[model samples]
Target: MIDLEEIRIVLVAPSHPGNIGAAARAMKTMGLSRLYLVSPESYPHAEATARASGADDVLARALVCQDLDEALRGVTLVLGTSARARSLEWPTIPPRQAAERINAESGGEAAIVFGRERSGLTNSELERCHYRVHIPANPEYSSLNLAAAVQLLCYELALAAEAGPVDDPTPAISEEDPREAYAEQIEVERFYVHLEAALAEIEFLDRENPRQLMRRLKRLFNRTRLLRTEVNLLRGILTAAQRQAKLARGG
Candidate 1:
């Protein structure tokens, strides 16, 4: 069973309170809850409550976060909504496929991140996501309102839930598999920090001239969807490298 509560609707830096409220309404109408507001420009305002139109419960219960990292603390799977393609070419999928993928997760928190109304997700923000859900609207003018985008994706999620899990030939992840306990966003982030430090220690990444080195590595791992055990193993290797580098330097 797909627990709607486990699927969080994350709004990143939403500038309008009305959109937040309307987004909540859209979620409630579709049997979705668990809204996470990341650095909302305006919230707990009268307009938001007014726009909720009886879904104020969703607004009241919304978790306010300082940033995407905070909002995604326990989330294992993350999908960011994007209106167009990017140069990096993330694992792009339509809303239906995104919904199916979210539904297929056996456990742990999953997030569908909605960016600001004007600029959408920035490069750094998009890099945090494992996949990008691209809504194919009329290309001539594909501009979509924040609330409208939330409504569309939420609708697909509800539909996917009602229809039950799709029949797929692939074997489901077992409890014994590390995939069952995929590394959480916070843990993965810690590994990145460790990686950067290890690289600098070994003089692999020039601290002053570091450009796309980290970004490219992030893309590689994000696409890989590393498991918890894999992350631990990688970090252990980085630790060994750092130790060896220090020994060579007579530290």
Candidate 2:
């Protein structure tokens, strides 16, 4: 059985204590147990207890922390919820995708963070998260309540759990076969060399006045975090360009 103990729902600076209680109830309905609160306005109140609706147990066992970092402590993965897309870049994935990732990574402690009801998570708070999860809603009006968002995420997670872990059908390659490398495993030096060579061949990087060409190119490629196939393709293109250049120079 996929243990719900590994998953935690974190509320940051929740304005309404009743919403917190309701969120606890929603989480319990989906079999999620852990609840972490980061500086809630007023917890353990009569209103919160009343709103819990027989789910006060969830609230009772919830962890209360002073700040976001304190609540996030010992959590290997953190996901932040957002309704509107922000100008700043963050790793954004749909709810389904996020659920799959969470299930796969449930071996470690993980938490899904929801912000205040009024304003939602700020850009800085979103930046603290490893990934951003956005629930799909009607494009015309997509405002989701705190409890609703928690319900949707918990539902997706439960569905994912029922569906079972996703399998990679592709057989592992033998030593003789070309092993595919993940983006993290690819050598940065090789990419730099390939890029520099390609740029030189194209006369894009002038030696006389190379103001910021290389730096810009480096930033661009680094952003991509190129996978094995992408790196190989780039190197191939650079090799072809070099060959063409050599032929032109009468090599």
Candidate 3:
């Protein structure tokens, strides 16, 4: 049986400690034990422990990090839960699909990250994830409590885990086998930074008035699930482009 413990449920900057507790309960119900919190506004509050109910152990053992990158340490695959669409089209999948993908990659560490309750994941945060998941809900009022969303995803993952071996003949690039590794979130962020700098040097990106151009590019590249070699290749391209731009300017 593929172990589900390799998956981590990450909550970033959760404002309400109650939501954290409820989310812990959700994880316990679905047989997931790992939880990571990044820069939570409040924790160790009464509301949180009360909401966790019998799942207090999860809260007790929850790994708290100073930032998202720290929380994502050693995780190869990252999925962001986002309700809204960005300017560029990201590889959006439903909860079930994400569950199946995660289940398939059972040996390696993966993270499904959720952002703050009010704003969801920001553009910068979403850029770090390899994929985005959007739950289909009432379009008129699609707001879901952070805990409810966590419960829904955990439930789907539990179902996927129990379904036994997946006979997926055509898994997407993002759903590659666990043995094939992808760049970590921190490495991907470095690539984004380098790419942005290279673009700015070439005058392709306006330093002063850069709009959503970099965000869109990030979405495009993230969809590729670039491996370490691919990231190096792309960075090499950026370096070459910068050299040409400098030569063109006689600098």
Candidate 4:
């Protein structure tokens, strides 16, 4: 069974206090408790508390973070909620698919990230997630309320958790397997940093005018659900490439 308790709901740069409270109430009704707030514009407000209604406990324990990285911390799986596609296409799935992925992870914490109500998640922020979750609505009038979105997704998660064990389509990696688990968000970010440096060293990625090259590369790696050891192997290659480039440059 998927551990509902291990799943955390993250709100990034929320603009309204009432939305936070309403979202907390929504989560509580659906059996989710952990809440992480990233640089909320206004929190600990009376409006938020009043909006939470009977779910003040969830609000009371919400972790307020300085940035998205701080909010993601140890989360092994991350799905960012985005309403529209960006300059670079991402692997987008519906709520049910997201629940399945979250349930698939047997040993790591999972996070569902909701971006700002108006702009949604920035391209860079969305890059941190393994998949982009989209809710299909009327194309003409598809604007959804922040709390309403949270409520719908939480409902899906509740159903998935209570429906008993499910058959995962992907082959389950045994505990003894080296690729048994995914790398944490922090580790993945470090690998991206290393990759960019290596690319720049090889004069492949222009430092000043980077354009969308790195973002596209990130999409390729992030969606692959890179394992810790896999990240190390790739970074080791990058290190060797950097060394070779330096030697060739006579530096």
The C-alpha lDDT values of all candidates are: 0.88, 0.74, 0.84, 0.89
lDDT of 2 by residue, 1-251 (tens): 23666688999999888899889899989889899999899987888888889989999999999987777766645688988676555677888887887776523366799988878897656645667898888999888889889989998888888788774222232334333532222244456667777778777678686535655554455444344566778878888988888787789
In model 3, what lDDT does residue 160 have?
A: 89
| Model 3 lDDT tens row, 1-251 | 24667689999999999999999999999888899999989888899999999999999999999988898887767899999867776789999988887776633478999989989988778878878999999999989999999999999988988997575323334436433456677777889899999999999899797648887888777776667667878899999999999999998
lDDT of 1 by residue, 1-251 (tens): 35876789999999999999999999999988899999999888888899899999999999999999999999988999988567667778899998988887776789999999989998788888988999998989999999999999999999888888775322354657655577898898999999999999999999997647887888889877777888999999999999999998998
Q: Assess the local accuracy of residue 178 in candidate 4 as a C-alpha lDDT between 0 and 100.
A: 47
The TM-score, computed over Cα atoms with residue i paired to residue i, of candidate 2 is: 0.66
Worst 10 residues of 3 by lDDT: 168-177
Candidate 1, poorest ten consecutive residues by summed lDDT: 166-175
Q: How many residue pairs clash in each candidate?
A: 0, 0, 0, 0
| TM-score on alpha carbons, each prediction | 0.92, 0.66, 0.88, 0.95
lDDT of 2: 0.74
Q: By TM-score, how accurate is candidate 4? A: 0.95
> Any runs in candidate 3 off by more than 4 Å, and if so which?
167-180, 247-251
Comparison by lDDT, 2 against 3, better one: 3
* Candidate with the greatest TM-score versus the true structure: 4
- Ten-residue segment with the worst summed lDDT in candidate 4? 169-178
Candidate 1, lDDT over the whole model: 0.88
Decreasing lDDT order of the candidates: 4, 1, 3, 2
**Please, what are the lDDT tens digits per residue for candidate 4 over residues 1-251?**
45887789999999999999999999999999899999999998999999999999999999999999999999888999999768788889999978877776766688999999999999889989989999999999778999999999999998888776577554465657746667889999999999999999999999998859988888888777778888889989999999999999997
Candidate ranking (TM-score, best to worst): 4, 1, 3, 2
